[model samples]
Target: MKAALWYGKKDIRVEEIEEPKVIKGNVKIKVKWCGICGSDLHEYLGGPIFIPVGQPHPLTGNVAPVVLGHEFSGEVVEIGEGVTNIKVGDRVTVEPIVACGKCPACKEGKYNLCSLLGFHGLCGSGGGFAEYTVFAEDYVHKIPDSMSYEQAALIEPIAVAIHSIRMANFNTGDTAIVLGSGPIGLATIKCLKAAGASLVIVLQRKSIRQEYAKRAGADHVLDPNEVNIAEEVKKLTGGLGVNTAFETTGAKIGFDIGIDSLKYGGTMVITSIWEGEMNFNPNVLVFSEKKIVGTLAYRHEFPATIAQMSDGRIKSDGYITKKIALDDIVEEGFGTLTGPEKKKHVKILVTPDKSLLSD
Candidate 1:
């Protein structure tokens, strides 16, 4: 089977490797479509964020140069012993999180906060970038027949957005501002609208992304470069800021926009996986009586998100901007996503089955 593995910073190789076989309590999926996530770009540019290097990941027990995709969906080809709910020929999408079932967080039904949290694809245990990969049956979810393979691949990201919104103290009819308009940021907009947010304002500088932000259900897309983000947000809210702010940019400026543009006592949800340390003053939160909530991966959000997408409560369309074969992953997938033309894309889906590319 051909798989794309991350060697190090800016190095992703597409090479032939032994196909993964289903193990006990696992299911093997034939790759259909896998979205190249922003986290994958982070590892490719400034690595080891979630990818293990010096020491093995506590969960998967594997190190760097492992398979490198997770936001994916596929068809089940085989199921290992003891896997009951899932069977062969089922269309499924993986939650992609690996947690110790006995951990405190897991026992408390907050496994996304597991002490030694790791991801299946990023940490090890094979990945969706290959033609075939095996994952525990628990994380493999069946998708409804109404969902296409491309949309099924987007469930992971949409689930992330739903989780973040569910974590915030945001209420229906409350206004919110989202900093950054990447795939995750755009997904946040859709989730916020679906959650009944009254007004959705976006702060994005990229022209194309600004357009995409509006398409994602943002009521007003403002360029931070032209006008002050905090000022404009206040104007829109009649001297008060948005009730909630979503920080999805992971940049220092995004942090500032997320906090400064929120109404007093508002809640800001940090959803981005940052690359480096950020400087902050505790006084900002103290003076305004505002609070911040941090959300990680989705926990039990897959099924609900799938149902929402299936029933049209949450629209999932037009996010896929590019598709490429595994052989062209390095240049067409990673490079293009991070290169000069990066802003032209919203989500890029990769497939190990080259035949699908021709389709």
Candidate 2:
């Protein structure tokens, strides 16, 4: 089996590795599609962010140079002992979160906040970037037959958007602003519309993402460079500003715009996995009595998110901009996504199986 391993910053090698075996209560999947995530790009550019180094990850016990790729969907090829509910041939998407059930967050059904929180792909347990990978059966959720593997690969990010909305307790009739129109940002826009938000404003720079923001149902798309985002948001919301703001861009400017675009008592959900620390005035929040909450990853929203997509509330059309074989992941997948022409792409799905490439 060939898998892409993260050596360090700016170094990812796709090498022939031993295929993972099925463990007790686990299942082995033949990966069909895996999207190169923004987080993966983060690690490639300035990492060891989620990739455990000298010290092993408390959960997966594996360290750096491990196989990567988590946002994926595949067919169940084999099952381990005690895995009864899932069986061979089930089409599925994995949640990919590795958590300790004993932690306070886990005990409270908030597993995404597990004290030693880690991810299956990023933390090195097993990843979807290879031809075959194994994981605890519980982390895999079945997808509807109506959905394509390419679309199912999007469930992971879509679940992220849904969870952020739930964290905000966003009201249907309320207005919200999404800062950034990247993969997660685009998903946030679609999820907000599906949640019945009356007004969804988008803050995007000059890129193809601006077009995606509108297609995802943003009521107003504002170029941060061309317009005063805060003032425009105020005017759109009748001087009160939006009821919620989703910070999907980890950039400082996006953070600033999100904070400034909120109304008094408005909630801002930070969904991006930031590359570095941010400096800001606490007085801003104190003055407006506003709230800024952070969302790590999806918890129990996987199933519901699939149902939403199945029912047509959320669609994956137009999200995937490119597809490449695992051999081309570093250049064609990661490079194209972060290079000079990055604006030309939104989501790029990589496949270990070449047969699917014909599509």
Candidate 3:
């Protein structure tokens, strides 16, 4: 079997590896497609953050230099003892978070915040970058027959968007702004529209991303460099300002703009993970009664996301900008995602099985 192994900063290698085997209560999947995520790029550039050195994961107990990739979908190849819900040839996408069900957060139904939560790609599960990976049966959800593998591969991120929108508590008539045009940001816009948002605006510097945002149902796409986004949003909303804003760019400037563009008493959902702290104005939030909320990964939304995809409601084709083989995992896959050429790229899917590659 072949897999993408993380060696260190800017050093992910594709090499031959032993195929994974099914364990009790787990199911082994033959990975078809895995998406290169922003966090994977972060780890590739400046890592050992979530991945520990000289030790195993605190929760999963799997160590560093493991197989990479988490956003993926595959076909079930084998099932371990006690796994009855899934069987061979079943297509599914995995929920990568393995949580300790006894934790307070898990007990409270907030498994994403489980005290002993461990993510598959990050902690020690050795994710879908490999030819085959095993996951708990409970973590794998069957995809509808109408959904393509690429669309199934996206359910994880869509669930993240769903959770973020739920955190915002957006109403049908609400006006909202999404401060990034990346996969998650654009997915947020799609979810916002599906939830009945009257107006959904997107702020992005890259023209390609802006165009993608428009195609993904953004009511208005603004280039921050070309126009005053805050002022334009104010005008569009008849001067009351947008009722909600999402800061998905993980940049100080994006954060500041999100705050400035919100209506009084509106909420801003920070979906991107920042590497460092940024200056935020406390007085503005205090005076306006505006709220800033943070969303982590998804919880219990995969089935609903799959349902949306099955019904052809959430179109993921516009977001998948590129597809590459496992052999080109370094150059054509991750390189196109994080390099200077990223301005034109959106979601890049990697296929371990070259037979599935499309023209």
TM-score of 2: 0.99
Q: Using TM-score as the measure, what is the rank order of every candidate, best first? A: 2, 1, 3
Error of 2 at 164 (Å): 0.5
Ranking by lDDT: 2, 1, 3
Question: Candidate 3, residues 20-109: lDDT per residue as tens digits?
Answer: 889999999999999998878878987876665687777777776788889999999899999989999999999999798998999999
Deviation (Å) of 117 in candidate 2:
1.5
TM-score result, candidate 1: 0.98
* Stretch of 10 with least lDDT, candidate 1: 350-359
Each candidate's clash count:
0, 0, 0
Weakest 10 consecutive residues of candidate 3 by summed lDDT: 48-57
Which lDDT values do the candidates have, in the order given?
A: 0.92, 0.92, 0.88
Question: Residue 358 deviation, candidate 2, in Å?
Answer: 0.6
Model 3: CA > 4 A from native = none
Candidates' RMSD to native: 0.9, 0.8, 1.3
**Local accuracy of candidate 2 as per-residue lDDT tens digits, 118-162:** 887899987989999999888889999999999899999999999
